[model samples]
Target chain A: MRLIADLFLVVGAAFTLFGAIGLIRMPDVYNRIQAGTKAVTLGSLCLLIGIALLYPAWWSKLLVIGVLILITNPLGSSTIARALLKAGVKPWSKASVSQPGEADR
Target chain B: MTLTLLEIVALGLLGAAVLLSLLRLILGPTAPDRVVAADTLAVITTSGLVIIAALLGSPLYLDVALIYGTLAFVGVVAIARTIEGNG
Candidate 1:
């Protein structure tokens, strides 16, 4: 039990770290949202599972938090993307580089 | 409260994750970029709270994590709506 719990915690933390790295490295807001939402959602779920395993009695509350994250993370990302679109933010594209004015908007 | 080597490693990784997200929050070029970083930071924080709960062998912190996650989601939505400027 200890071994499995530890493994889950470590793997989850690693995934989270990668997500943050992606947030920093991605070129645009949309890409950053994608990376941050997907990776961190999964990482958080794993962390919750690990904690549940470590303390079996805490499973119910952990499950609540996990489900909350599972639902909200993607919803929040999509919401932000929609807002960005409505606010006139454009998605990044390689072709935009050739057209400097296009890149600005 | 002694931590196992694996737990220590996990905590360190989480710390590094938080720092990276904070850097993005600081350096993000646009408003949406910063919002995304903030949202990611909230999720990481929720998980970090759970890990801390495990470390301290206290179930109480899980409630804090739960509430924090819900509020963070609501806050993100509100910010998004503000950014949209239509509602």
Candidate 2:
């Protein structure tokens, strides 16, 4: 049982690491936001769940945390995206992808 | 033991999903893409919070997660409206 719990922890850590990587590796602001939000959300969830699983007695609380993550992740991303759009940020075009959009535009 | 394996797999899958979403973020051409990315991130965060709460044996964390989720959602809506209104 303890071994199993450890596995969850490892898995959670992997998720979080990837998420952080995605945040940096992805291209523009929009993409970055996507990477950051999705990766971090999942990563955090895994970490939390692993902790819960390791301590099965706290199943109820863990359940609550899971629900919260499911709800909030997308909401934050949308807010950020909307703010960017309002500021007049444009989307990537085929041409823009090959070369950074700002230079081409 | 089996349950542990399943949880690991779930985490892996969720991680992959986050990556897929990241692709959208990278390729997304507009501000909305990024906004969408952020939104997606918020969802993932909420999920993670619940998972940890269960693992750690604590219910108190749930309330904080719930509040955060609600606030984040409201924030997204507000940002969306602000963008549309300006446009």
Candidate 3:
């Protein structure tokens, strides 16, 4: 049981690390939001579950946190994306990168 | 009070994750980019808080994690709405 819990924790941490890397490496805010939200949400859930396994008595609190993340993470990311669009932020595209002069128009 | 090897590795990975996210938060080119980084940082922090609770062998920290997660979500939504400029 302890071994399984450790595996979950390690895997969750690794996923979170990937999400952060994506946030840094992605070319635009949209990509960064997608990477950060999806990966980190899953990572967090895994971490919570692992913690619950390690301490079974804490399952109720862990479940609450997990559910909160599941709902809010995606909702928050979408809200940010919508806000960015409303604020006139353009999404990055291959065409924009390939034809830099065209992007200005 | 000693951590097992796996716990240490998990902690290291989470620490690296936090550093990377912080780098994005600092270097992000625009407001929305920074906001996204902040949101990601909040989620990571929530998980990290839970891990800390486990490490400390206390249930009290779980309440902290819960409250932190709730407040972070509310804060993010408010920031996003302000950025949207509907008002």
In terms of lDDT, the best-performing candidate is: 3
Q: For each candidate, report its DockQ versus the true two-chain complex.
A: 0.78, 0.22, 0.77
lDDT of 2 by residue, A1-105 (tens): 666665666666566656656655666666666666666666666666666656666667666656666565666566666666666666445553555434435
Cα error, residue A72 of model 1, in Å, equals 0.7
Question: Candidate 3 on B1-87: residue-level lDDT in tens?
Answer: 576799789899999999999999999788788999999999999998898899899888889988999999999999999998952
So what's the TM-score on candidate 2?
0.57
Cα lDDT listed for each candidate: 0.89, 0.63, 0.90
Off by over 4 Å in 2: A93-104, B1-58, B83-87
Candidate 3 reaches a DockQ of: 0.77
The DockQ-derived docking category for candidate 2 is: incorrect
- Candidate 1 per-residue C-alpha lDDT over A1-105 given as tens digits, one digit per residue, 9 for 90 to 100: 987998898999999999999999998898899899989998888888888888999888998889989999999999999999888888888654675444545
Off by over 4 Å in 1: A95-105
| Model 3 / residue B74 / CA error / Å | 0.8
lDDT of 2 by residue, B11-82 (tens): 666666567666656766565655566565555656555655554646666676677677768877776877
lDDT of 2 at A92: 45
